[model samples]
Target: MTGSIQRVALITGASRGLGRSSALKLAENGVDVVLTYKDNADAARTTTTEIKALGRQAVALRLDMADTGSFAAFAAQLKSTLAGTWQRDRFDYLVNNAGTGAQVPFAETTEAQFDQLAAVHLKGTFFLTQALLPLIADGGRIVNTSSGLARFSLPGYAAYAAMKGGIEVLTRYMARELAPRGIRVNTIAPGAIETDFGGGLVRDNAQVNAHIADATALGRVGLPDDVGGAVAALLSDDNQWITGQRIEVSGGMML
Candidate 1:
């Protein structure tokens, strides 16, 4: 481990969707990966298997982003995993991408539902970073997943978008604070993608797909890998100069 100069990234919510895609991309690019899943251990292990096929080190841990109390223990276990699996002390990148999306109208949005969104999206990001900041290497990178809904007002997503907007601002503050340590912070705001987000409506409903496709200037909904590649690129050493910015990967939607 002394002479190994490879970078390692810890991606939360890496069990599926965009996080899984990002993990695969980073692994393919020779970056070591530490990915986490909330529940689906089987799916997460499949991702790790694929990463190992890429010939890079990969490990998966159980993580629940909504449970803030477990973060310290989570961080400790992650550190142990890193030390045991990769023989490394500090990881090079941190992608705060774990979140839950809900589609509820403003009036009907219950206090419990709104709190759930705030807890996972806003509070989780804020506190999780605080907990894991020690393990992130100097001059590292942080990518917070935001949403295009934060830019354009979208109905039934008022609370979710608001929390994402908070992350946009938080990204700027993180960039400023971590810049001194050479750790760049940024947000990737993706448009509609074929993920299980919001009950997999886009993937299941042709009408939903049509509406999204018509809205998208690319004439198609985004793939998970679209946001994933953008994330991997943002964390790359190639993107050293860009920080504190929210880059939208929306396939030109809402233009």
Candidate 2:
């Protein structure tokens, strides 16, 4: 887009945590945002209010990542939203950041838990992007959320990490196929952060937080803004040459 046209971004799971921070950071950088939340309409409204406070247009919509069947409807709604709000039919950036957390050992992990993780993180992301392909602008960018666990060995994360690993691979393939449209696809892997994910183990538990901090090269667990800033940087015009790479925003964790 030209300097005169304000760009728009659609971020999934943006009601709170890293997603919320990413939306806010993009807003600070003068980008409008279309944020989605799974079940918390109030949080989504609050985020949009804050984005609008930053002098950028913002809207909130409900989206359940695990429901593949709803993606078509979601895309239609998104198209209408874009037309109504911006007088356009496409958005410039897409952040596939919606997901749920699970920490179950491989031996004891139930199929139900595994299915939920796969449905939300892997299957949901895959099909949702496919469903939204037409609505994404030709030169747009897509950021897929991965996890540091995919690269590092951790117990009770076999299923979750596996899904993330799949996401990393999918990023490479997406980058390759979508290159014709000048659409860059990359992965962002975040280390332990003090978020509500996984019951906030790293954020609320002093012992766990201290342990993670000790292992991290930066001497502290990640915050939402840590990842948010990296995401904004990755999607910036200056980073056009970079794609299909996994950029870890873990503050040098597990180095």
What's the lDDT for all of these models?
A: 0.91, 0.95
| Steric clashes per prediction | 1, 0
**lDDT for each residue of candidate 1 in 187-250, tens digit (9 for 90 to 100):** 9999999999788987778898999999999999999999989998898777879999999999
The total of clashing pairs for model 1 equals 1
Instruction: Quote each prediction's TM-score.
Output: 0.97, 0.99
Runs of candidate 2 exceeding 4 Å displacement: none
Clashing residue pairs in candidate 2 are none
Q: What TM-score number comes out for model 2?
A: 0.99
